[model samples]
Structures are given as structure tokens and as C-alpha cells.
Target chain A: MARVVVDVMPKPEILDPQGKAVLGALPRLGFSGVTDVRQGKRFELEIEGELTDDVVEQVRQMAETLLSNPVIEDFEVHVEEHSVAEVAASEGR
Target chain B: MARVVVDVMPKPEILDPQGKAVLGALPRLGFSGVTDVRQGKRFELEIEGELTDDVVEQVRQMAETLLSNPVIEDFEVHVEEHSVAEVAASEGR
Candidate 1:
């Protein structure tokens, strides 16, 4: 199986109450120093077989048409061998 | 400012209708080959200053306490200098 991850975020112009709530709760929980927080959506799709360019395109279409609200949100389609943390660690990002 | 991303996914046993809906809509939209879809949450936090290990720890705590529902979800905290798509592309993931 192939794993393709899609990350979706609200448009910058949009207001996100859920993010705001998290930001507000930080100090109360004794975790400070955060200036802002924006919440989004993540989708993991397990394709039945090998991941080809055509399948990637189809997944992108799926993200744009059904997974995210184009008017107020944006999304990214990622195909990786591992999870996000490992990627970050590998690149030291 | 430091930009860190947090990715949270529902536990495997959890039912995700939103994801299922996306899967169901794919073929109707003429985009097939997807076997399963799982949805989660992504958070982008803009810290006020540098991203130190301590700051990372605080952010992790924030994620664990407020950003994600631990009982039914799992999360990854990534300290990065760019967006998720850029990261994925940089690593060719």
C-alpha cells in the first residue's frame, strides 16, 4: 500500500476560533511563549497499491474538490516513506 | 518568530466519516484508486522568538494538553522553518 498525507489549513484571511481557544488555554496550562496558533486538517490516505504520478494527481484533485473548502482553505498532498517527525529530524527543520 | 507544526491523527480504531465521505466521493468525481482515508488535525504555532529545545518541550506539552485529544488521537510535534509541503518537497518525500 501507498501512503499519501494531505495537510489542509485555513486561509490566512480567515479567523479560526479553535486555534484561538488553544492559544488562550496555553498560559492557563503553564505553557507560555506562544504567540499564535492556527489549526488545520490532516488526512492520511492509504492507496491500495503503488503510488504513481497519476495517483498523486488524483489525490490532489480529491483534496481540492472534496477534502478542503477552496473558498477558505488550502491543502498540500505529500507522499512520504515515513511520518512528519522523521522528515523534520532528517532535514533538521 | 519560530514556526512549528503539530500533526494529530485519530486512533486507528476510530471511525472517520469525513474521511470516508471523501473516499466515497472520489469515484463519483472520476478520481479512483484510493483504498482508505483517515482525517486528523494540523496546528501551526508561531512562537514569539527563537525555537529552543525548551520551547519545543513547551509546545509538545501544549499539544498533548490542549491541541490533541490523547484518548482517541495521536500527535506529532515538528519544529520546522517552513511549511509542510515545502518540507515534503525538499526531502522528495
Candidate 2:
């Protein structure tokens, strides 16, 4: 199996209240050196077979269509090759 | 400058209400092939210097200390080497 990773984030021009909340909480949480924080979303998927470019494109379409708000958010997809042994080792019972 | 990416997610055993909420919203948003969706947080840092192993470790500690709830969330940090040309090309006006 292959590992597919998706990262979704609000467009730079958009106001991300969730990120703002996290940024506001950082200093109180004891992070001093941090001057700014922008929050986004991540998704990891274990596809059932080898990762091909076509599959990656399909997932990207899915992300654009339903996983993210294209009007305010953008996303990136990363596909990594994983051997069956690695997949089995990573799997949880 | 180097780009430091941090991904934070709730521990497998912890309840992630936000992820659940997003998963619930997917179907309504027209994502049919998706059977499951897990949501996490991402942070992109544009550090002011070359990314050394020491800086990566320091950022990891910061994530553990203030960016994530150690009791419930786990995080991964990825530091990519970015050349000045690539960095300049990627910069937005």
C-alpha cells in the first residue's frame, strides 16, 4: 500500500478564526519565541494498492471537490510509495 | 529561509471532535468515495535561517511544549532544505 497525505489550509487572504484562536492561546500556553501561528488541516490515507499518478489526481480532485472549501482554502496532496511489508508493519490491529 | 512544517494530530486513543465534525460534513459536501476522514493541524514556519538539525529539534520541543497537548496530541516536524533561489521564487508579493 501507499501513503497519501493531504494538507489543507485557508487561503492567505482568508481570515482563519481557528488559526487565530490557536495563535492567541500560544503565549498563554508558554510558547514565547513563537511570533505567529497559522493552523491548517492534514489527512493521511492508506490506499489499498500501489500509488499511481492517476490515483493521486483522483484524490486531488476529491480534495478540491469535497475536502476543502476552494473559495477560502487550498490543499496539497503527497503520495508516497510503501511496500506491503511496510504497510503491514504500520497497520494497527 | 527554510520552510519548517509541523503536523499535529490527536492521539489515536483520544477523541477528536473537530475531525468527527469534518467527517460528518463531507457527505453533504459531495465527497462520495471517502469513507473516513481524520482531521489534524498543520503549521508552516518560515524560519529566518538555514534549517539545521538543532533548529528542527528545538521546533519539535516547542510543538510538544506549547503547540500541542502532549496528553492528547502527537506531532511530526519536517524541515526541508530550501535554496535561496527556490525561496525567492516561492515568495509572494
lDDT of 2 by residue, B1-93 (tens): 666777777676777676577567756765444444556778866565656777777687777776677676667776646422233236431
Q: Which lDDT value does model 2 have at A75?
A: 77
For residues B21-86, could you state the per-residue lDDT of candidate 1 as single tens digits?
878878888876788888888999989887899988888788778887877777788776776545
The best candidate by TM-score is 1
Q: Positional deviation of A64 in candidate 2, in angstroms?
A: 0.6
**CAPRI-style class, candidate 1:** acceptable
- Across A1-93, the per-residue lDDT of candidate 2 in tens digits comes to 566767777777778677677667765765444444567778765555656777777678767776677777767776646422233236431
Task: Give, for candidate 2 chain A, the lowest lDDT window spanning 10 residues.
Answer: A84-93
Which stretches in model 1 have alpha-carbon errors above 4 Å?
A: A83-93, B84-93
- For all candidates, the clash counts are 0, 0
Calculate DockQ per candidate and list them: 0.45, 0.27
RMSD of 2: 5.8
Candidate 1's clash total is 0
